[model samples]
Target: MKPGLFVAGFILLFGHCTSSLVPKKLTDADGLVIRTGTSAGMCVGYCVFDYVLNGTNLTLTQRPNSVQSNLTTKTCQSTISQSDLNDLLGTVDLATFFKQPAVLGCPDCADGGAEYVELQLGEQKHRVTFQYGQTIPGSEALVDKLRTHRVALNECK
Candidate 1:
């Protein structure tokens, strides 16, 4: 074999051997919390929503215009099935998800709206904020699941 060919082969083999030394993030459902919310700067009637998922329990808190005396914050309780929870968890690509920046696109600009998703796995916490209707490139599956859950929660009333 040529000298250059032998050197290149050795480097490739060495790199492959050492690649396993890096740690990888694991997705553990225990103590995992997923939260999604939306807000609009200029709106009326439940302009803000906060949804929290812990295990199979899901809670939603709705906030309206604070200045309006007639509008009051509301809280609702709901439970998601274990299968549904598993499905949601399965959509998470930890490798891609964790690498995303904290914020994406301009959020809540010009009162268009803003949406955010936060995930907590044990001690690790990550949050991504993006334009109201836009989906993060790497997290589309997870976000789609979350959006479905959010819609279900909104129809709880």
Candidate 2:
């Protein structure tokens, strides 16, 4: 066999092996919420929001909201309404999320006008939308975050 041919075959085999060994971690959810902050040049802020799926309904608690204080490195707490809390724990299907219109001026180019996962929590259904093209990067991260939250919720139950 030619040396060049042998090298090409080995490269192809190695590439296939490496690709197959990479575990796909995105199959653990039905949908995800990708939240991205407005970007300025090299600096970018990103967050992942996930839905805690509790059977068919999600629970919303009236926890205190916090704000960072400039005087002290502590947070200030604020009260929230029950309605507002319920509105926050909703869940939805992954397909519907990918069908909604994208918000204008998304910081993450990956999330340019992509649909978001709509969740039905408690008695209300909330729409969790993401920027288009972000279904891969942001979406995946969002799914993982949601999964973590879901596990925590399960533990509480």
Best TM-score among the predictions, by candidate number: 1
Clashing pairs for model 1 are: none
Tens digits of lDDT, candidate 1, 62-82: 987566568778899899898
Tens digits of lDDT, candidate 2, 1-157: 6999999999999989655433233222323222222122222222222233333344422211133122222222223343433333233233444444544345345433233444432233445444533443334544444444443443211
Model 1 weakest 10-residue run by lDDT: 20-29
Each candidate's TM vs. the true structure?
0.77, 0.22
Runs in model 2 lying further than 4 Å from the true structure:
23-25, 28-157
Give the total clashing residue pairs for model 1: 0
Prediction 2 TM-score vs. true: 0.22
Give the winner by lDDT. 1
lDDT (Cα, 0-100) at 25 in candidate 1: 35
Worst 10 residues of 2 by lDDT: 68-77
